[model samples]
Target: MSSAYKTSAVENTSKYGPFTKMVDVYGLKILGLGNVGGQPQVSTEFLNKTAETFKLLLDPNAAGINKKSREKALKGLTSYNVIQRVGVKAHITHTRQALIAAKYRAGTKSMTSIDQEQTSSGICDLMGGPTLLLEQAQITENLEHALHTITQFALPAAFPQEMNISSKNGKASGISGDLYKALREAIANGVYDDSDYSRQR
Candidate 1:
């Protein structure tokens, strides 16, 4: 339910208390797609709906998901829902590009209507895209938010031993070692769900 990475993050093994730290959750990095993903600029109108990782939790036909995994994810909001910071660097000129512009990241402030928030998500979407459809862009925005829940919230909360990592300083233990390889292999073979979290020496 709670993120457990509470106030100020004081020590390697000591500080976190029991409150839901808004800062920790709020600052959680969601989506970070950029133009430099090496693909040429498409019409800013394209919404990559195929990467629907968020929709996985709402599967009515999720017979593959165990009961425990299903319950843990579908808890908050009576369902699910946003991304915070986004990197922006599109060269959308008004005459040629219609809506987007060449600039730094857009912040969530310059809105005159309930629908026109300043923030953007999933690449260059804050200023809308080539389709010129308001509703479509809004849907893309919401999808970015849901992306965070699966990656940072519910999955780690339900299966901490497997998903969460341990470390000192900055190097994460077992990340590139034998344990990491075993875990990677297990998931590839569809056996990760049955494997133990603890790594044996």
Candidate 2:
């Protein structure tokens, strides 16, 4: 972990229960786990946290309000039609440390040394269309990329070997190193598409 990962767990009032939020040195929040009664809070908070995390992923230097990523993440979050798509079924468990894994992905993916960092946390399988579907024609695709990035790259970095999500049937498998580079490059070049916002148009 290289002391890069920091955990902040708070005991909430009886109404909310306790929750654990994990962040890295960049102030990028990586995970949010519900504790005790907090499990119910996860569904509501997950989307916003996930949005913030995506913004941090794209622009680590971003701070304050990030309305763009938030809005886009919202649309994307609703458009993950995974079963409809013919994506492959595979599983991968990250045994590497969080920081190390992040660095590896960032490095091999050719990320620039962040001048600074700021941050937030669903996560799921990857499902993007041509030209990334992120820097493309819709918010749905953008979300697909965002979720993919989180599920494949970010979650593994956060949870490491325990990245699997249990399902009613069993456990489903989980990305690679190259697509991440593409995401960084596209977003850096201001290629995120916002043509059709889900349920807003």
lDDT of 1 by residue, 1-201 (tens): 244211122112111111111122222212222332332222112222212323344453577767666555444212233222222223222212322332333233111101112233343435443653445565654455455445444554456556553343344443543445676788789976633544542
Task: Look at candidate 1 and tell me the lDDT of residue 39.
Answer: 21
User: How would you encode candidate 2's per-residue C-alpha lDDT over 1-201 as one tens digit per residue?
Assistant: 212222233222222112233322222333322322212223323334444445555452357646444334333322321110011011111211222333221111211111111111113323443342221232443355455545643444444345433233432212223444454468678896533543432
Model 2 lDDT, residue 81, Cα: 15
The alpha-carbon lDDT assigned to residue 194 of candidate 2 equals 32
Candidate closest to the true structure, highest TM-score: 1
Best by lDDT: 1
In Å, residue 42's CA in model 2 sits off its true spot by: 34
